[model samples]
Target chain A: SAVISQKPSRDICQRGTSLTIQCQVDSQVTMMFWYRQQPGQSLTLIATANQGSEATYESGFVIDKFPISRPNLTFSTLTVSNMSPEDSSIYLCSVVLPKSGQGGLGGYTFGSGTRLTVV
Target chain B: GIQVEQSPPDLILQEGANSTLRCNFSDSVNNLQWFHQNPWGQLINLFYIPSGTKQNGRLSATTVATERYSLLYISSSQTTDSGVYFCAVLINAGNNRKLIWGLGTSLAVNP
Candidate 1:
């Protein structure tokens, strides 16, 4: 079980601006996931970042709008570009850990999440 | 793509009541999980019950993988249990593993 420290737990940004959210995991992991939870909506995966490779974005999401940087196994950053009021939502970072007693299997752990407010 | 459906979009109960939440998926999954999103928007993993049953304290979950469904039971609920409960199922796509999430069931417990 790894603990992820996510910075700037919350922020209020002006429209047309940009914001970069960072997640630092205490342990090394192969893949880090970025998700967006819009107001009163279920979580949506934005992209998956693996060290030394380009991030793979989900359908309806683009790399230019949500750029992801996975510089190392223990760190990653997600930047929301050209923000708008419709972008107001909570952003979360997640990593998978070896499931207890399951041997090779794993479970998901998430960062505390960043609450972004766009005006 | 996988589809997940959770029953009872919302629930309200007394502090000591008991309840059950159900999740149905359209396909076989590699794994299934239950999560609780607190008031502050912190997503907490409640269980990793891909099959069979597992219990932690007053919360228990069962995932009948063969039947493509899962159940979460909350006994003697507390106000602290009030939040959004979600069921997500993981599916393998080529070399990648992705989680398909349900809309979630919003719960409110009052004193």
Candidate 2:
């Protein structure tokens, strides 16, 4: 299992401000993703943070609003820009082990999540 | 795009009771996994059953990929088992490698 240390577990921010969440995985991972869990809802994929490349955003998600940075295999960050009330949610970081994840041996790993509230 | 649906929406069970949760996908999936979101908001991997049956302690899961459904079984449930259970799938048909998710089943186990 790859452990992820995510910072700023919870935060209260002003409407115009921005917040950046960080995740540090215990080991190098080829696949890292950012997810958002809306209030009283299920998890939604935000984007796939690729090391040394631009992230691949999902439908209805854009780079300007939810920019991600994967500086290396073990480190990544997602910044919620120009925060608004609608941006408030529980943001999570997830990973997949390339070797073990294949042949049904692999699974997704996740961070504890960062709960954000924009006022 | 794949649609994943989880049943019962919400569930409440007395401690020591057994419960079953199900997940159904709209299309075929080569990978499927069950997760437990604890009260503290941590996503814990419960099972990675893309197919067949697997048991771990008091929890077990079975996935019939051919039929596009999966089941999670919890026996002798405890209050600590109360939380949201989610089924996530990875569809790798052609170039579609996106991970699809279910709305999840919220469980409340009381003492």
Candidate 3:
């Protein structure tokens, strides 16, 4: 298990403004992912951040709206550009630990989440 | 893409009762995880049983990879267990680890 933390557990922002959320892990991880959860809905994968490479975004998401930066293996940042009322949701960061052997069991460690409320 | 399904979209259980949640996947996966989201919106990982059974206190999970299904059992439920339980699956294909998430089951434990 890894200890994960997110900054600004929650925040209220005005429309048209942008908010950058930061995620940090206790140890180095190979894979880091961003997710969004709307009220009364399931989790949606936003993108996967890799060190020294451009983030790989999901089909419905783009880099322009959600820019990601991963400068190192243990830290990453996600900025929500041009916030809107619809952008109000919980953003979570997750990391997959490396397995010990081939086809070994591994799980994801997620941050507490950042709750963004856009008015 | 792999499809994941969870049964009993919503459940209400009294304290001290036992319950089981099920997760079914459409394809074979190399990794399977169960998570518990508390009222505070914190996701606590419960199990990483991709092929076997694991137990932690009052919570236990079993995954049958060949059958593409997993079971999560909660014994002696408490009010603190009232929240959503999510099952995530990751299949090993190509060289990428892509995880598919399920809708989750919402459980409410009343005291």
Candidate 4:
């Protein structure tokens, strides 16, 4: 299994300010995913970031609001731009760990997550 | 877009009891996963079952890909097992694989 480290585990920001969350993996991975979870809600994927390409965002998300940077396989950054109170949520980074056998599919491992609060 | 639904939005059990959680998808999936989120908000991978069945200690999961549903079974429940369980699926759409998430089942095991 790969270990992931996320920074700014919890942050409080003004409505007009922005916050950037960083995810660092111990091993290089082919893809990294970002997800958000509002209070008492399910996890909603923000985007999937593949190395050497622009992130692919989900239907309700836009790159202008949630800009992502995948500089390399081991590191990625997700920035919530011009944040608002509605943007307050817990952001998480995830990756798939390949394993032998068991139908040749690996498990999904996630970071501790970054909890953002827009005041 | 594929729809994922989980049943028994909330569950309560006594220590040493058993429980089952279910996840249903609206379409075919290449990947089916079960995750547990603890009180501290850490997501832990419980099972990755696209098909067939798997067991890990007191936990086991069975997924019928053809039926588009999955079940997670936990035996001898403990207070430490109190948390939220989620089921997610990967729908391959035009060379891109997107994940659809379920609302999750919140479980509370009392001592």
Local distance difference test, each candidate:
0.94, 0.90, 0.90, 0.92
Query: TM-score of chain A for each candidate?
Result: 0.94, 0.93, 0.93, 0.94
Work out candidate 4's RMSD over C-alphas.
1.6
lDDT of 3 by residue, B1-111 (tens): 799999889999999999999999998888898988888888888888878888888999999999999999999999999999999897764556777889999999999
CAPRI-style quality class for the chain A–B interface of candidate 4: medium
Recovery fraction of native interface contacts for candidate 1: 0.71
TM-score of chain A of 4: 0.94
DockQ of all models, two decimals each: 0.68, 0.77, 0.68, 0.77
Candidate 4 Cα outliers beyond 4 Å, as residue runs: A101-105
Candidate 3, A1-119: lDDT as tens digits: 67898988999999999999999999998779999999877888899999999998988999999999999999999999999999999999999876556544357888999999999
> What TM-score does prediction 4 earn?
0.95
Per-model RMSD to reference? 1.6, 2.0, 2.2, 1.6
Query: Which scores better on TM-score, 3 or 4?
Result: 4
What residue pairs clash in candidate 3, if any at all?
A: none
lDDT by residue for model 2 over A4-119, one digit each (tens)?
99988999999988999999999998769999999999998899877888888888999999989998999999999999999989999999865364344368889999999999
lDDT for each residue of candidate 2 in B5-104, tens digit (9 for 90 to 100): 9998999999999999999998878789999999989999888878999898999999999899999999999999999999999877334366789999
Clashing pairs in 4: none
What's the i-RMS for candidate 2 in angstroms?
1.3
